[model samples]
Target: MTALLAAWCLCCSLAFASSYPLIKSKPNDTGSNLLHEGHNNTGMADRCSDRGFNAITLDDKGVMYYFRDQYVWKGYIGPAELINDTWPEVPVPVDAAFRIHHRNKPEVHERMFLFKGNKAWAYYENKLEPGYPKLITDVFPGVPGDLDSALECPAGECKSDSVLFFKGKSVYTYDLSDPSAVKERQWPLVQNCTAAVRWLGKHYCFQDTMFTRFNPVTGEVHPGYPLDTRDYFISCPGRGHGHETRRNATLMSIKNRCSNRSFEAFTSDDSGKTYGFRGGWYFRMDSKRDGWHAWSIGSTWKGLKGTVDAAFNWENKMYFIQGSQVTIFLSDQIYSMVQGYPKPLQDELGMQQVDAAFTCPHSSDLYIIKGNTLSLVDLKNTPRVPGQESSIIHSNVDSAMCNSQGVHIFTGASFHRYKDPNELLQAKELPEARNIAAEFLDCTQ
Candidate 1:
């Protein structure tokens, strides 16, 4: 059985190299070709046929379209599935496609370029632009004639180039600038792969039934990779063979980013629901619901029109903390602000200038954070009285929240947890809670 298993592994590894005709001629002695490089050969052929998505591209409106041989699935960043039951076929079977959204150039709308063999087609507003299906050599000067996959990066995140094109076993980059030059460069170590996508600030290479994440800056595959393809995309074996049915939830929403304003947005979470505010914008994340819904703070919470610096829920009441002002409203009252509210923290708790706040999941104490300091506000204490119990517990807190697990605090990129309110938050539940907070609260407005 051991010998048979070894033979099977070798066969699958060879099949991986042989499956891509474009990469067959390349030498296999490079460090990127080591065993456990991208994906194991086992069950790869079966999984490959299951993934009906052949190509993917993002539209001008930020809608991602996943192309199959016959149908195109489109939707916003999250909850994207097939659209228009009767979709038109591409001029040619596409090996890859990407949209060019000129952010700086407002006059130029988005244009989708579909690539196949040595030719490409440009489309605008879903209509074929005039004089398209141009030769790759003529349109994309310096780019290789054939491409297995391609992805574009927004201007802010891309290091050397805005567009990355993959062919055979190597990668090329197009700066998307004047003179239009393509550089033969490699990072995150590209090897045998079927497709690739740029998500957040990292690169993902997909092959067969597995996927691996690489830190483009480090030129190394990040630890804990070669993940199952199903975790990121719909895994349906034999679904793409022929007469494939429509697949929903084909892509994970985490791949999408919200906005920059959420770098340190005020946030609160309860019963799996998270509410966040940045400036006058507010977004609520109902884990039970679909995508996030963005609303103006004034519209969502009447009489509130400033950045929410801190917030929490206590006794079914929602608290909005902005600077030294603390406003209270009934959790059930989604519209009007509470009467005789909007009191100053200095007058109530003797604490001023709160930054972020949350209630302890296990106790009655309300945790308020300001800069790096944390103050435990005892809810059981009487208000307007000097004996109101509140103490400074810790310093250097970036954010704090109470969930069912314990008291979670964010300092720097680390997340510390304490199951008991009286205990110190010693366990590092999350390595980087700041980033997680961004995603959990839909911080990107």
Candidate 2:
């Protein structure tokens, strides 16, 4: 059986958000920072924090459009501006919008479709196409009017280039290549998609102030999602109530310098839920959790305490390596720490502390990483023991994961995708496929 999970949740600027309003943890108190903290304070007031958007779309030139009641925020870093001031031909308060940027299709000419009421308008590079304001059905057959949100799922992600039209809890997938292959389904996590946009190569579904990153092909959302849209999408200096945007972080929300994506101990268990550890909090990779985001590690994991150096799952059990010690937990129906499991790492795995570790899909070999070197542990054998350590592809590995897709090794804010375990084991420096900030989390552009 194969597992699917985000390689690692980028240690985001908001991973341990003090802006969350009245929640505290012990992690930042020890004077340790999982990542650096930025100190730049934007003097401007107002937070892109809790406001909702009516429509969201990205242009070919990388400009992001965020609409909310006749106003729009045009880029990642900016204040709200009048919609008419920018796109003169486009109407205000567009219910839904999606871009068509296919190279093969010239008739549409890299245009954008904006929906309002029952009518739809096509804009080529923001210029309204002639004979527009047509019925929604006429523009996008099989799609309903008054959509909650819409975004393009281009080829390679979805089977074919397609558009997702959202309404309440229902999603209508309109295939661009084949009009007859329309599909409709219910996604409970996305109760209301006020806005959604496809940036880089990932898809995001938004509601209120939160957004969830999801796969366009399978509609599988990353676990521990539904994070704040403002933290990742909009740059609001003094966002955490006087705290400014920075490349580092502090304990208190008042001192937060949000926007450095770094994380520790990223792992996925037998149940398929992925967990990302940062400071005193952890983000679970599921969006179905009641409009929630991060959780205190102690509040959920139970009994496993202190700093987590590395983490991985084997035989339906979770292993969290912290400094010289390791904590084991039973990951069955109920998450519980195994008795007498806060043992020394050397006693159990014949090792001290490690940088990162992960078990690949359909294999019994567990890769335990340290620095740029790694040791192998055969899980199918009687006793688990680390073999000779040798050099590997990445250095300062923060986390690792394995799904049917491939083995992902995360370092800093970007990660390398190895087609399989063997491909990763033989590498010196593989090509990085995605950035944790841009692709994994909907945090940066």
Candidate 3:
């Protein structure tokens, strides 16, 4: 099995290299065309220096579109255009948004509504559409008048039968199982419904109350086991089960109350019913002057059924640069955990700060970013037995995306793809990847 796996990995590496056709490099000045007429400022030039002026996305049909924020300076909706591959200048509205949030499946048609004061606005397709961001009475029949508190709400379909919406203190559920589509509200059930995941036909919610599982259709909380609530706010949940589920679903909770208190990170098998506490870790500022920091944690988070094995840590503090290297907190320290044991398996990485991280459909491969650079890690490489070091995939670029089939990294404006074991082995050759795989090191430097 070991030899076969090694051979399979080798072929995958070659295939990864061959997936993209090499193109000639153009002068870095190509991005300047998209700049505003009077923006001759060097600061603006610096922003487009290393960064490509436009972002690209491949649709289900494999058609690539280039997007740019025309209103980036005005603090308004940035319009994106479907620039032709041949004519990159002709812009069209592919989508528009005041801000964009990245996720594994950030469909253009899907909308995220944020409550601002008494009103709400829907952020979708890269623009804020004119409409009530809250659940309308038309969508949820017989909503209470008192519930008209203009709260920010984001709704998603957990499964065919389960639809969930995150409000302030409550997460409401709508059951599509019935022909009539009855809406059932479960408020104040999970203290903070910041992040949620659906597994085994059940929905898990994480917030101030730790984690809890609910029947997607009935909105009933699970009976046995509740999540560890030692901390008031559990940030991420379901770390190792990303592809199998959604969101890392990894839960981070405050363990104590020191100004810089240690925290615990864990994953749940019984939906959110029970969580296996990994260990304690802390977040620290990366540099005193930069005010950037990194998060470091122990290998306490695990996978469902405790079958997949992996370990995780942040590689660097989040930072961004425009004209000059400006230190900005792009993301919190990252935490990773994997599936399998003894040998490398699969893994998932979660951003401690930003809402962007890559999750494979059902595979253990995970990726996260700091600024523009991307890093890959595998949970399968770690031993299931205690006290073992796991392997991680690393790259020099910014940002990465992955599915069950393979992983892709975004360097400059282009993307590079890699297959598993081979990708893992190739990653092992690089210095950054090797450093990340070494014993847990603090990135707060």
Candidate 4:
């Protein structure tokens, strides 16, 4: 009886420890009193209203806005004046959002993308454009939906039209320069990142009441952050704040149950060798080998460290993808990385990090798979312009390899094949080719 009571007490303490304090100000605390509750009374809005806001983003005009439930509160730069009570007719609850400065040569305009679940709405001056709230896959192509946070990241080689979206530990960058290419970066795992914003050139990520400032260029957290958010934005109490307290509590409880998540950061090469890596730690493995051989990524792999998110083989050469950077390796050696090699993938093939890739043995045509779409890369052709082709493969591909037998694709635990009839007919004629095909299947399966 005593042990049971003690366990109960400890569990209660842990629950209490995870709870964030409600840091709302009184009714007449600050800002203009033009606040009004949204008319849309969905269950999601109730929970979001109780939590105050899910995210806060800054516009190109330097105006900051807080998004909660279906309502939006626009504020100015200094003194934090409320531009409008419930500004912008936000149709639904927002999961993650970012503002974009769409510029195509002579024409330039401000655009906002609001994401909710798998759908996203493109807004211009608070008005939804024609055929909006489309599937995020349709708009962003390779980016996965249901993002936790997003920000307009305009730094480094990324064009002014690029935006970064976060889902768990992975960061997906989509540039308007070429909508087909989607860059990815594996970041340290963070939980419940409620909001993110850029102020004074540095990015600040928020998890409930705490905030962390990150350097956009270095991708490192700046010193003096994870501080109380009250130090930055003033909390103001308004309508719909009190009515959804219970609903907020329920959502928080649900989050506690479903929020425990773990993801892998690894890649594989064409030779059936899987490499497990995270940050600086790395390990290489082969089915023929006994076990994983752990090694220091920086020392062993040289320029190709744990930053590699995807890898593939084409014409005896290996391609490594890290964000927009691509590193090449010759089939013969693994000691030193090729110099002047970590160039942008966009420059070569006009596509970003691919999900899966395989080269056709007969034609030497490289198939680059990103999301559910596929692009054929004919290396023989100069001045590559990526053209899309119809494919039966789905998104979230695991790996792909091609040999004398056929093209094998893996998505999760399932395996698929796209056999070229011409190659099969030709292979039957040559005895050596048949043996090679059998060996290739043995290595892959």
Candidate 5:
């Protein structure tokens, strides 16, 4: 009876230890007010009221396309365009329920495709043609089975390749070798293959919550590496084959279970050969208060780096968002020896959840797409002296596109043609530009 009582007391102590403090601060404490305000501020609540944007699609040339449901729209931004500038809106080929699977670059023209119900259709654009994108092929060949996911690999110098599609647990490799003759070869029984990417010189497939690097050249599946199935979300930021070297190529996985709320970061040293957990970040929320913390490899949870809700790494720099503020760090240096991250990048962009952020593949500028706006900051554009203000380009945008050509901003449905800063500035006078800016500015409020 005495031992039982002691065990109950210990359990209660642990529960109390993890509980949020009832009274965070005194009533008249100014410091308390600041803390309260910081915690209360959650960017434009409406932007995060729902998932800001569902999917971001980019073409080989780096044209960015995105879809927003609140307004019910789909559009693309050209490489040279700014987000706030006007761009042409492409009507959804079928009905409103359809979504884009992948955009393919075949020969000299680009094509957009969508998956509807259990079928996929390809859109074609011809410089001198009058017809709209025609339904090219019904790639799936089974009883109303859903078209799971798809990706396209641009044709390299000597190898003429095409897009790859996955359905159920199997993958089909399409040959765009001849735009006139597109062929698909099925590799059957690729169990639980939720995601697949053409990486290194092989086709890396993710199945059973694990990664299997398959050699397209040899048609053999290599041994699989185990991954935390709890965190199934993954992102691949590069293209097929030789481009692997130039790609920082990191995969981000987040576990959203109420009890197991944590995020994991994984990177490839040599194209998915080995994946080690960089660390895990967690957020705890109860009725009254919420707090964030992190744990590095082999370290206790008490040794946290910082409190963060979301994080992404680019060009060796890790950018984390906590409430409305943003913080940056040289991940290797910080995780190795530096105890803490350098001071955060000043809150110049105001309170905004990093809806989407990525380093430009062709340049050193860091591009952040939030809500309906885009902000650009150069890593090298910082002030020479420490703690001094640095210049940044803030473009009131609706969408962003980053590719080999450069970063482009979209103002409306149509991509405005601009060569230099002067042309882009003059574009604001165009009718489409004015309407888009008016619509986007209203959303900012």
Candidate 6:
């Protein structure tokens, strides 16, 4: 009876201990009023769900704005912002958008058009045009309402400097010079283009998370039609080998991928890019994404070679540990290794055989994990002795991280999260490990 009562009390304490919601999971976002009760603030809605973007357009300066529902991503990779913040006059749920760019017609060229339902909005440099919020029928005379997507078709690559309006499987080609003479045709290449854009003298159409490059004049979709958006457009971490199934491709279970499996090293850098390493490959986890994509260490880290044992970002520098060696790289526009790096772990920090290394917010100390022991080493002293050494909850931890919110001890594909290091040491007994992939990394069943 006493044991049962103790177990219930422990469970209650654990439930109450989880006060901090995991980072990048939602809320405290933008610090804007938009981070309200029900509104999603984790940039790219639903934690990197690619249901599809409704509209995409490039500004006069060639800056891309990808819109999905009420949020807009300024660049390819984004912690998205509310549409009203950028375009206060423009309404939400934009169906289609396109910017005009013509050297000959400079007066009207920079103007952009956004379509939704029966309404058409025109803006020049983000300011609503004098006469806008016009009906779609009035804007193009014959263009249908509730457009799927739209893009500007320049004359050099097209028959005319026209605008392509997509709806369902059909397209309406409206020539800017001759708006009355609208041509409509069934587009067999792609159906219901979710968003379309004219980028750097080329035209591309998107359907869902898939896209196709095509010629507007010849109506020819390039041979490699319907490519995954993450491949070229955005910087999506935890990405797989193309969403489309290929005949020659070998499918691997989630167990094989570090994203859903054991991690050799894990760190959330000062730049806010969360990375997990396994073997020779590393996965960059986006703040707003519940996905994983792996890249080779040799290819990404340049000079860094082989699998890493531990990684941690301190100040503006990133440290990668391998066996008894440690390599430090500067976190900047380019991650360049510092001079005289790849130093002996013992010689550099007086630590040996580190299983994992991590640091929490506002702390100048690095926590080194070895077996079940943790050694707190100050960054101020090199070849330093341990300041506060203690035994932690888990033994033989595959990897670990102290991501501001809490400390996670990763083992195999699962992770046991504790509120903090002090609490874990106090508890003695480890908590039930949760599937890291299932909760945030989104493993394939």
State every prediction's TM-score relative to the real structure. Answer: 0.44, 0.50, 0.28, 0.39, 0.28, 0.48
List model 1 lDDT by residue over 1-445, tens digit each. 0000000000111112111100000111111111121232343132234464456565443344555554453421112223323224344346777766456554433677778788877776666767776887787777876687776655544554366777767776676664266677665356554666553234656665566665443346754567554433432332211112111111111111232323234344344456555444444544211223334465446566666766777666677777788887665413346788898878766677765677754356776666544457677687732233343445665556677666666554345566654554333233333454344533322
- Measured on C-alpha atoms, candidate 1 has an lDDT of 0.49
Candidate 1 — worst ten consecutive residues by lDDT sum?
A: 1-10
lDDT of candidate 6 over 350-377, digit per residue (tens): 8767888888766678888888888888
Model 2: lDDT to the true structure? 0.64
Winner of 2 and 6 under lDDT: 6
Question: How well does candidate 4 score on lDDT at residue 312?
Answer: 58
What's the lDDT of the predicted structure labeled candidate 3? 0.28
Cα lDDT of model 4 by residue, 32-85, tens digit: 111232222333332222253567764433345666655554441112222223
Q: Residue 415 error for model 1, in Å? A: 29
In candidate 6, what residue range of length 10 has the lowest lDDT sum?
Answer: 1-10
Indicate whether candidate 3 or candidate 6 has the larger TM-score: 6
lDDT of each: 0.49, 0.64, 0.28, 0.49, 0.31, 0.66
- TM-score (C-alpha, index-matched) for candidate 4: 0.39
Where model 6 places Cα greater than 4 Å from the true spot, the runs are 1-259, 287-291
Q: Model 1 off-target regions past 4 Å? A: 1-52, 75-89, 104-109, 178-180, 216-218, 235-445
- Please write out the lDDT profile of model 3 over residues 1-445, one tens digit for every residue: 0000000000111111111110001111111111222221434222122222222221221121223333122100112222333222223222211111123235423343322222334444334455444444443443322221211111232334333545555545444343255454555455344344332122455443344555444456645335432211111122111113111122211211111222122111111111211222222211111111111222212111211111122232121111211122211111122222222112112222221234344444444343433444453555312122234454344334344335544333233456743474357443232111011111111
Error of 1 at 115 (Å): 0.8
Winner on lDDT (2 vs 5): 2
Clashing pairs in 4: none
Model 2 residue 265 CA deviation (Å) reads 7.0
* TM-score between model 5 and native: 0.28
